[model samples]
Target chain A: MQILEFLNTHMDMVYIVILSVLLGVEVISNVPSVLHTPLMSGANAIHGVVIIGAIIIMGKADPSNILTMALGFLAVILGTLNVVGGFVVTDRMLEMFNKKKPGKSKE
Target chain B: MGEYLLEISYLIASVLYILGLKMLSGPKTARKGNLYAAFGMALAILATIFLYVDEEGNKLQNHIWIFGGIAVGSVVGWLAAVRVKMTAMPQMVSIFNGMGGACAALIGLIEFPHYFGHGGSILILLTIFAGLVIGSVSFSGSVVAFAKLNGNMNKDIRLPFYNIINTLFIIAIFAITALLLVGTLTDPMYVYLLALISLAYGVLFVIPIGGADMPVVISLLNSFTGMAAAFGGFLYGNMAMLTGGILVGSAGTILTVVMCNAMNRSLTNVIFGAFGTGGAAVGPGGSGVEKSYKEIGVSDTAVLLNYSQSVVIVPGYGLAVAQAQHVIHELEELLEERGVSVKYAIHPVAGRMPGHMNVLLAESNVEYDKLVEMEDINPEFETTDVVLVVGANDVVNPAAKNDPASPIYGMPILEVEKAKNIIINKRSMNVGYAGIDNELFYHEKNSMLFGDAKSVLVSLVAELKTL
Candidate 1:
């Protein structure tokens, strides 16, 4: 009954999920092919939002429960890598496009 | 009040994410878009750290582990992103995406036991299983894709009856997941079994795919990672996580479809076709007829290029392999100095990933406006005086059009043969990644400039200097 009650209260979450999917599709379909790599990279970074769930679980987990702690720690690390690495790499890629004049710099 | 603040922050974060993606569509606003998304991420992380409260109204503990993990991850991620070469961008994206998938899988692993112990609801259990299976598959599949892209694994490994076996494995996974959701399978050990099977499926799924199909595979796995993250969002009912996951999921799916369309292959064909197998099969022109090609030296190529009023360069993975981007840019500049207009024709699946040639050419300071997509540039080829094919083969191959018997038939190509003259710079008379002879090489209007791409461009630049 408690779980059922919880689900009933959060039915809006399901609606949110559906609407978000539609919005996401609409927004992403407009991206040109020239920006495909950067956009993919950016989206990859966005999904690093799983770091939130990782942090939440880590916060509430029993410190003595080694399995939970280890998994939580690893999740945080990997999620951070996804977040930081995805954005930075995307920025580096987009930097090439922002500079209009050729022969400005070379890597 | 604090809870309200946390919820508001999530709402703001979601808006910023949408704005970021919208801005990302344009070249001018793309960097700002990335920064906006980064700022949103930073806001979400900070809000969660300071304001999040559980059902029991307790603040998050384990600061040591949380901060330490973030520090280690940030340093490693930052250094890797900063130092990665433009050519390695595909594999780098693969590896980073794999990490995200692994993180989501780990969340499921950590949470499954707690829910099982408490006799959690079907919805919670379904969310956990969904996250676990999808996340683990994305993780392992992306790792395989990374290895394949990085040249660590070149050959496709297909077991006998792989398609049927894979189909059955997928069905079994689904059946087990259903049983678990319905309370038919109560044992906690099934969780481990499910995770293991999912990981194995991921490896098997990617192992049989050939190199040329990597862009599609990577895009598919990228979408898988996004969906896994979305499942994680479902578990927590977090708005920002859900929105981000959905956005990525849709974006990756569109990209995968675009990549597959470029090659004229369906998703099912890409997944099960195990293309690029059979080892260099003979093409329609490969046998029964002796095809002759004209070879031109550097000076002649330069002369042909210099006298041309308009030229289009078709770049492929071979260009990246030879690191000829900079020299090619030099060639372009020299040609422009002589009043010859130059532009690059980029195939959708050129290089290794989408827009890969653009990135490579951009790194050497090739203007983005000069990099034209296949659809737009194909029409211009007719008016082009010369089509300089540099380290590119299959995209310009006319077999994709004129020969139905060709493996690449019906696929859209650059239509470079429509140009007045075609000068293909290649190392030798070798077949491309598709392992088929390009009929374009034997066309009368085509002349082969044979050498390494970098050296060829360098010599051409030198020859142009004297002209």
Candidate 2:
């Protein structure tokens, strides 16, 4: 009974999320030509946000319980990894800009 | 009160993402764009923690495991990144993207069960499904892409039943997905089956793509991973999802288009062309062909340029690897001073990535109007007096003309072969990333000046001074 009541109240939020995700998928599929590569490279950088969010969520969880603590600890580790890894990857990608143009002489 | 604060932070992160994307659209501002994206990610993370609420409407307890996990993952990630070589960077990117998909899928798996059966919301189920489909595809597809990039996968593997098997696997995946959704199966056993099927489909998705198309495949898979992460975010009601999803979705779509343009194929053609089937065939070797020209020093090059009606400059990966755009710009300035009409011919997949050549050229302040795409410039090559090819290979190779057995036969080339006189600046006769020998080297109109791309160009610039 409790579960049924909860479902009825949250139905609107559920429908909204689904509709938004579907629309998001459609928009994602039809990206314009000029912005493709930059868009992908940029989005790869944003993936880092997941790591930080996961860390904070775990950090505030109950530490007294071993299972919860373990989950939180794992989250923090993965989160940090994501953050650091993401930055390193982004930096490396940016370094491609530093390459010399072919068929051009160095000063 | 705290939720409102989190919402504000989300708003800030969203703005950063948009700013980052906007800045990335042009070459001069790309560095600033990268930094903006990093800042947005940080904001999203901070906001997520602030808004997290427990079952009793109180703050969650301290989490030690999460911290420990973060510490370990950071160290490992740092070491892996620091030690990776530049030559292996593309493969490393594939591996890292695959890990992201795996992580998202795992999160959905662990979280969904807990939320489900106890009247778990549809949002949770949908998120799980999204994670499962996208994550699984990314994880498997990336592995195959990595294999191709590393030469572990065969460049020309065409079996009779390969396509049939791939079709069957895809069908099975959809069947299982339908069963899971319809509540026909109640056990976790089906979950594992679904994963296996999806994994198989991922591998099949990339196995038939030729080496020439690997870059496009990689970019497309990257978009898939981002979409998966965004879906996961939606399930959790996390602001990060809304921001990250929008950014990734937009970016992925854009990359797919760019990759398609590079090969002169549509996105659908790339995905469905499977088995090394669609692109141009290779041309006959120009071996033993008569060469009419002698190796000329930079002074000779400069003298010839003085009376030339028009000059076309071709840029390739060698430029990007050596970081030589500025020097090229200086050379262009010198030529333009003598009233030489110089235009740059940019092949779609000229460098390691799409727009790589454009980005490098734009960095050196090369005028946007001076850069011409493959289709727009091929016709002009016939009337071109001097076609200077700098560190480029396959895209300009004439083998696409007569060699049906060659890997690049049908693909449109820059028609540098059609020019009156061709000056190729290269270090050696070595093959390109596609591992095919160029027939353009032995053509009668072609002259090979072997040396480092940057050094040769510099020498040519110095020689121009005497003219």
Candidate 3:
């Protein structure tokens, strides 16, 4: 929460976010078509940071806030699944692109 | 000192994320890049849990729930990655992406009560509501996409007044969002009601789209998830979250455009509506004549392929369906032994998901260098001795170029007809996923080899040995 206030007060982070979005567009333009699916999955994983945000908000409530806790708990689980599954699957897919060898077909 | 450590780690994590994205551009560096990005996520999670403090300087102590949630989700994700077949990749990607959207929506839901509290910045509340609407839409839309792809639901479901309803629904969402922004809507029910409405709208948003256009849909939903997450970042003022979300949103937008261009469809058409409701017949459509392609025996195809100086193989969803990548790799090597130049022609939208065919071919151990894309391989077909099209249809259709009345008229296609000889393998005359007949199949130089892709390739391998 202090970080949130710190960010709003400083105000520069807002510009940073906007600038980052443009910089990101530049970086993404270079991705090859062969890696596009993995690129989608990889970007999906990055958004999983919402899990941390949910957990922080849940901390402000007392034990009686079941709905908030449940929502936060579920959010954590879903976010983790996205991040872990997305990266692992992308890795597995990339590993399959082994360099083929020269010569006759193996029997 | 502890705070400084936390901030440093986050900075490092962001750098790693950017580095990972950069590394993923090439085939060789992609796996390591994935690892680097995963490590970045892990670091961010660890730092947040251990170092989080409230604005009042209270340290966070909720440990068990967070750890437990992470553990369960990890197991589920791990099992999914290990157990899923390569052919089911599109649905899995959609499902995982849906989870990301769900998390963003939940954040908006959890924070709604506080949004009305005094001193809540109007900007923050607006960002929160953006997350709620976009996140709900993306989550529900992705679920529908998954169900349709998995055959649990019908592939295309159309209703009357699609464009009218879609436009009105979007306008209503904006109106409600504007109302909420003014702080006049006090009841929490309004928020819940908005979420429900948005979810329903999302379902309607996706059902009208045809299965052939799903890869583009999935990529667009991913961008929605990213945009929603960025709203959360704005709510919390977390630079890492904001950076990650913006990166995803921008990248996804670019990919959606790329996929749209590859299919030769405008983004406006893809979004407002396409397919489904139109009474377009799905067939070997409108070539006017009862065209029949020449049928070739396995021995003849083998002889032709054996003596050819150059052969380009075109692969599509059918190749993935039959799991024929390895056999094709074997055929390529066999032909190479006889000194025939062999290469693969990959259509951008070849499989159900973008880049999916490349992954499948890689699984079969096809060399990265041998795989050529449509733009680079189109000219090569003119000089090529033969083009062996495997389980591919709409991509190679000359109708995209010649038939002005065809549904897929303006779409870009592989110039397989330009090759000296074209031999296509298929189990039957059924059209491909686009539900359109391939004119390339009936071209004067084209011949059909009837069989499953795997069986035909296996026999071709055997026949090549004889020559």
Ten residues in sequence with the least summed lDDT for candidate 1 chain B: B276-285
Flag the better candidate by TM-score, 1 or 3. 1
Q: Each model's number of backbone clashes? A: 0, 39, 0
Best first by DockQ, ranked: 1, 3, 2
Candidate 1 residue lDDT tens string, A6-98: 668887886787788787788877667778888888888888988999999888888998888988988999999999999999998888776
Per-residue lDDT of candidate 3, residues B376-433 (tens digit): 9998988999999898888888888888766677888899888999999999987777
lDDT of 2 by residue, B271-311 (tens): 66552343333223335554444465666677777679899
Q: Is candidate 2 or candidate 3 better by TM-score?
A: 3
RMSD of each: 2.6, 6.0, 3.4
User: lDDT tens digits, residues B150-208, model 1?
Assistant: 88997788899998989987997898888888878889898888998999999999999
- In the range A1-107, model 2's lDDT, one tens digit per residue, is 74578568767545544554454344445333223444455566565455543554465544565664555455455445545665565455454543433323443
The DockQ-derived docking category for candidate 2 is: acceptable
Better of 2 and 3 by lDDT: 3
Best by lDDT: 1
Q: What is the TM-score of chain B alone in each candidate?
A: 0.95, 0.75, 0.93
Q: What is the DockQ of each candidate?
A: 0.67, 0.29, 0.56
Rank candidates, lDDT, best first.
1, 3, 2
Question: Please, what's the RMSD in Å of model 2?
Answer: 6.0
